[model samples]
Target: MTSTVEVSPAARRSAELEDEITADPSRFRILTGDRPTGPLHLGHYFGTLHNRVRLQRRGVELGLVIADYQVLTDRDVADDLETHVLGLVADYLAAGIDPDEAMIFTHSAVTALNQLMLPFLSLVTVPELQRNPTVKEEIGHSRQAGVSGLMFTYPAHQAADILFCKANLVPVGADQLPHLEVTRLIARRFNDRHGPVFGEPEALLSSAPLLLGTDGTKMSKSRGNAITLGTTAEETARLIRGAKTDAHRHITYEPGTRPEVASLVLLAALCEDRDPGEVAAEVGSGGAAALKARVTEAVNGAFAPLRARRAELAADPGYLRSVLRAGNARATELAEATLAQVREVMGTRY
Candidate 1:
């Protein structure tokens, strides 16, 4: 495990965030995943997935859960779940999440694992659930529609995912800090009652910017503003063309003043390895029309390799399945060990 005994605040936040969970480096594991609702977009890349790739390559033990069941809790968009999962798998592979290095499995496949949620639910209180930021945010976004029991109870399920793998580090954005807190609370409670069997996974926060969608809102596939990883070059250009930008008729990198245009410029800079301010100046030199075109070109160029890699992997569905199957087996090994520990802790072993 990398030590962060000395580093600047920003560097500490960015690269050396695992100091929180180095208490037992050998037992440290990373738990993270996508809901598999839609093809992963640029938002996920910058948000969490990119970091997963980096950490996994550096020998981080990771378990990615395909929260397929969570999709139905909110809505009935059942048609594309499988496709979305496969697409996500492809995205992960394309982004360098080696199947051998990390375990990737779906929620539905882990029956014994999901069973842990029942006992785990008893370990947490309703007040704690209500205090969770993720749950509260989901309720607020429901627009007065009654929140489902699953939505309220999903945190326990998440706890199952984390503790089942004995994960000690959870990569998350600032918004997800509450969910991690709930996981830690559950771990503490379970250990207090049972034994110190699970590690309290600390939040491995990222320094990457929380990217906004094309519409200047937090990026989400459901919001229709996302630029999915599966996006074609033409689609990316079209989104850039229609992306929300400031009306100053010139480009600038002031996110406060020109969020829409500035976001596009930043994406361009990220792709081109140039300064956003420089990109902004170029856009300002030209009109928004020229700026949008430049941004589009830069983005297309940047994602070209990833686009090709994803397409190649998508061509071989059997390869994707094999990867998931192997990952499922590996995940099961870790999960069964945790389950065995749980059974022993509570004297439930028959």
Candidate 2:
């Protein structure tokens, strides 16, 4: 049975805000990022990375945060944290995030940003934190016997991330609206308690098409089902060819009855910027093999340049480190200014 995903009231409000921002994209500052647990995947591309690139092209002041510290919230140890962080930098550059235009920094690297967490934490209560759906979902996924204090209070840290940069806009998916809501609440409370210091950032819902995993589930690296941005064209083709599809020979976009095949159709549609029904119709009785081939070709063609760029960027680790150093320096400057304003407003500037 096909289950319907319910749209929350927050998500609806976010959609309206997104429309308002769409009219004047440049007037707003955008802050978005990923956790550097692993290399980014096609899901990252369609979900937010592509939108970041587009926003940068439009001259938006974009702040990309690699939440490296958050990666340790659920885990006891991460030996390759530095490697993952650097890998994330390579992926962003390879994905067309211009270093000169956008400020990409690691979460831990910005000292003042991390310090803001303490003051922000005081503004939010445990019950309010508990209400965050994203946290609840993550806890459920981890299924740990006990939740760490860091994990429980990570939403506040996210508030610090958004508020520290003074970001007026944040790009997120519908499922992430609750998390954004928490950030908004913290901003409102902070402004109310101690003058207006931070912009109440609104969610810029990503318009990119959502691509399911090869196994017809949500794409995730942990699940070993994601097609990473770093994957070679040959490997991409192999993975797509191995993707799950319905036993029915005929191809159609019947998401309710034939979700597996429907997903491939959706991927093809997004890759070609065409309607899923239209693509399905054009593919017409070609069966799973033909549909898979089309999806493979579209995906490979779309990512060919990205793969090439990523390879070159990956080969020069020193260059990537220098980029990160530059980003960190830029981020620290902005963060220090914001934190100073925050301290002045709270009468703690001394």
Candidate 3:
């Protein structure tokens, strides 16, 4: 007799949402974004940004947040916050994210949206917040401050970001599914107790394999392993040159046994739009040096257009500011409408 394996509720929901997104993506409103801590790297390009672009093109109403306020959750100061925020906008524009198509705004810019946090907090308990894996991981990274209040309630804030716009779809990697659980819980609890003021957002999971940094570890800017979009072509080559790889002369794309080498191969494959195994086979016996060379070439070629576009965007800071202004205006409009609904249900309109 064969025993049936159990599927997780999140997994089951994700599978169902995937079909909906494919069937009629236009029916979905997707809320997703990144923290404006620094420059977005290649890992982010493939992991989230690229997927956002695809979903937007598919007619999904996408609201991309800059998460500027969240930058302060772990860090003590965000002195160059403006630069990072604008830089994020430039990167989005460069990466083919049309401002006309997707509403991109910062956390601080949406006051009404932030106000949703108060009521949302009531829906979730402290114990439930502590149980969030993403929150735990983020807290682990920031040992300097121990744990900030914002950091502790991050999942709730994230839920507010989602529910404020009544977004039904959230594109997230497998690891981030835990964060969405908090959002779903808050939405459900609020609707049952207060009223249906928010939509229970489901995860639109990304199928991309985890892309490790050059050092065969997590990709991060601080660790100097990340190949950021702002990096020069020469810098990319230098970084790839120093990447950790096996001593095997013949290359093969087997991530389980050879993650480092497979990562490099994956980079090349992502750039050239080919299978990792095929790219690895083509570089047969060429070793790490050759693999790096091909990756460098492919990466430089692929990002050339984006780099050029980014430069044009950077030159016109006024245009960038206008884009932000428009996004902020749109975000405020949505938040105000949601806040009105929330007040009506909670009888707090007075």
Candidate 4:
């Protein structure tokens, strides 16, 4: 028989933190980011981008990092690094991430943040790194025979990214809870050894439901199963048209028994901001074809505005570069101050 462990006090506290909304958004500083390996996708939109836009609108201090260096942990080729990074920026803009409201910077641009990662590396052990669920899953998915040192230590680097700006709220999904736990552990350990120089960041679980790929599997860029933000309306329709669906003649949202159809129904509901069951009922007796048509329509409708905005943004390459440069400068200013304090605390200021 298998055994289950009770949730730790810290984990329990982190879960509770998600519910406590800040009345004054300015008082809440959030650090959330994505690796610039590919363009943002529908999964990215519902999973994190939507919440980021909502939070930025709420007047929160937001720092968005384009983790360029982190992409090298698993892959060796970065032939189009600049293009991919700019694509991410354009996607962010199209998804309502205001450059003026949220600071968007690339990882390599912030040199001081990397310097802060050294001491953090010493705070965590290799076994602890191996134990992190997120790391383990990524390694397994990548099917790498051997994990790189960078891959092993990326979590520590992540801690530095969050602490550099002293962000107290990190928006993430439930599956990412372990990563946040590791970040909080690093913070507590550093404060205990050096001083209270970092805030123990809390995880703000995303309210968005997990979105599956059209093939009824986890959405992934490597798998070519993602519906990218830059996907055109016609491409979106084509993808949905080819998506898997059961032979059952009636549409239903029973996830367990009808996952493929349920996935499409979920996507439709999210796109239309309607209940999944309600959407399923509306598509009654119309069968797989009916569900596909509705899903295609909903998805294309949602992407139309985003596609237009992204096109406009992509057409102005100079403006995107300037946004990244300005963000880099802003991030450097804040990161340097934090690094200086860290050096002083560790008596390495010389």
Q: Give lDDT: candidate 3, residue 126.
A: 86
Worst 10 residues of 1 by lDDT: 17-26
Candidate 2 lDDT, 41-84, residue by residue in tens? 98888788888898788777899999988888646326688888
For candidate 3, the per-residue lDDT at 22 reads 83
lDDT of 1 by residue, 1-350 (tens): 88767664444553555663344345567889989878888878866777888777666788899988887765655577778888889999898788887899988887768888988999988988888877888888874369888888888989998989888788776566778888888889999999889888877767676567888887888899988887999999898788876668766788887677777887777778888898888778587788889977887887888999999999998899888888888877777888888899999999
Off by over 4 Å in 2: 1-25, 74-77, 143-145
What pairs collide in candidate 3? none
Clashing pairs in 2: none
Q: How many clashing pairs in candidate 4?
A: 0
Question: By TM-score, highest first, what's the ranking?
Answer: 3, 4, 2, 1
Mark the regions of model 4 whose C-alpha exceeds 4 Å error after superposition.
1-22, 143-145
lDDT of each: 0.81, 0.85, 0.88, 0.87
- CA lDDT of 201 in candidate 3? 83
Task: Give the true-structure RMSD of model 4.
Answer: 3.4
Tell me the deviation in Å of residue 283 in model 2.
2.1
lDDT of 4 at 115: 90
Off by over 4 Å in 1: 1-27, 143-145
Could you give candidate 4's per-residue lDDT for residues 116-212 as a string of tens digits? 8999989999899989886787788765678777777878988988999999999876778889888899999999999989988887766667678
Error of 1 at 225 (Å): 1.4
Task: Identify the leading candidate in terms of TM-score.
Answer: 3
TM-score of each: 0.91, 0.92, 0.95, 0.93
